[model samples]
Target: MSTPQDINVRQKPAVAATGGGTSTILATKQLTKNFGGLTAVDGVDFSVAEGEIRCLIGPNGAGKSTLLELITGQLAPSDGAIYFDGEDLTGLDTHKRIDTGISVKFQSPHVYENLTVEENLRVPLQRTDRDVDRVLAETLDRTALSEKAETGASELSHGEKQRLEIGMAVTLDPKLMLLDEPVAGMSVDETDDVADLIRSLHDDGMTFVVVEHDMEFVRRISERVTVLNQGEIFRQGPIEEIEADEDVRRIYLGENA
Candidate 1:
């Protein structure tokens, strides 16, 4: 697949870049999430640059999902704040967050099992004031689901279902996509196809923060990697730095390490 423009993943000086300049699409300041006494996510500061693909990885119960939940407004943060495109999002509801151009494709392919692929894409597109017919056609081609337009979602393979669900989100033209375990059960070829889809979309200026466990897939698509451990960031840098760190390797070995 083709590569995107070279990205400088290093931290940038905050010069009030809103949709331009450094282009940090999303950021969290001392973000935290707690369930009673258990702190699932500590005061974590995370950010993703626009037109970049960032991979979030770590061992089980590493607060990956919690952090995503906080960003997506699935779970309210116990502390800290969330910023998207220079607007405060910590208080917005889930739908409001979506309205601000943040779309999420959770681990499950939550497509309408009974609906055809085209119908499924139409559901989200029709909800907005966008030109449904025009965007639907574009989403089909962008998601590689053009041939499956008339196919029932239940009749599709796992990979196709994944693409359909992703297309559902793409219909509304989201600025940043947070994907959770996008290739959990796919075959080798299917995983590669998803990687290529992401790369193509990234080249077109879509930003992504993908939470995945597949190391091979992560390395293939990620310009930057963040390793979370026990609700705190353990490592953050290029994939090569994350891979070469002995501490990060041991952390993945087990949570207790």
Candidate 2:
């Protein structure tokens, strides 16, 4: 199993003027995904810099999830290429991707409902050679779940369960974490809490690519935004720039926004 040390993750990198880092950690060229006659993701080129939090948003069926699936190797791309940390991830399986410091927290909480919080962390740790006790402690504290260490996941609040799921991914000390609708179905306060946690983790040098719908959460979590439409990149830049576009407001944000 590979670890963060194996890849030499460059932390605290100098971010570019437009919210991108000097180094490109992940990139896809002409990436496309199709299901027979329906092309969900058209030919697209995307990139993410190291130590950056990138948000992907669009109206329904804009291919946000499909693009994420391609990166995680959940679904193979019909065309184009995906490169990560200077390695080709085309044929690599999801487990291999995790070994290379790529972990994901899907849209829903995926905790072991029957298990305790500490036990849930242990499952992912089984893949790593790190000290179990130390990781469990750190993950609990970082996720603000220390008090619930012995609590069953099914008993935790919705937000706490989300945190636990995120902690499960962070236990491996991944380099990049892909989150899909991480703040879904949460109160404003809970959503804010998740955003703060992500920012705190980013401060610790973990990169993130988040697929979210809540614009407020997106503004709070990411400086750069990528808007996809019709399986293609409609626009990408500073959050304010994307938000201020008239076409974007008219099409996705609507007149009231």
Candidate 3:
């Protein structure tokens, strides 16, 4: 595990592109989603680079989940286009999008409690062409569950369960990972452990698009922050700029601002 300083979690100048170089792994253009008379995700443009760790933060009802669902193909957008790895993904279904290197881990841990950590990993690995043993070992080491490989999912702590789900998501070797509230319900030490795991994975060339409300956790691992409000992008920049913005302070931070 590396310190925040050692991990390169500093603010950067504004840019139209993120990740590494000009490669955009995921992009949503004029993305919108509505439920009858109510709009959840209004027209919004969002993009993430190839190897960036981007955090999406906002208040409840800020359309964070809707936006994530739209991108993941769990819900269809009323209008808009989604592109991934330089191809259109707007009309693709959830499993199809996943087949193309887009994987999502929702807020809850969806592991098989009766299965061991390694067995849970095998569920997803069997779907891919990779060698099961090699990928399993790597995933265990990456998620810091190497010693707990044979432990049943039901026996693991809340944080360990979260890590197991993450490991399963990576079994297919996704190019872009959408993590919703990765640190939700985690203790201080657990959160720190997860953050360190995330950083370690990023260092290994993984791209992540995370939706998290925990500001301290966000500050721990984010290279950039995207602030969403009222179903749209209120602001997007480095964490420093976001923390300094008067409008963001007023709407999101409130008295703390």
Which pairs clash in the backbone of model 1? none
lDDT of each candidate versus the true structure: 0.87, 0.88, 0.87
As for lDDT, the candidate ahead, 1 or 2, is 2
Candidate 1 runs further than 4 Å off: 1-22, 253-257
Q: lDDT by residue for model 3 over 119-232, one digit each (tens)? A: 999998877889999999999998989999999999999999999999999888888888999889999999998899889888878999999989999999999999999999
Model 1 Cα lDDT, one tens digit per residue, 46-154: 9888888999999999999889989999999999878788667777899998998988999989999999999999998766999888998898998888898999999
Angstrom error of the Cα, residue 61, model 3: value is: 0.3
RMSD of each: 7.9, 5.8, 9.5
Cα lDDT tens digits for candidate 2, 1-257: 66776443322121121123338888887899999998999998888888999999998999999999999999999998787876767668989988988999999899999999999999999988999999999989988999999999999999999999999999999989999999999999989889999999999999999999999999998979999998999999999999999878876787654
TM-score of every model versus the real structure: 0.90, 0.90, 0.90
Worst 10 residues of 1 by lDDT: 5-14
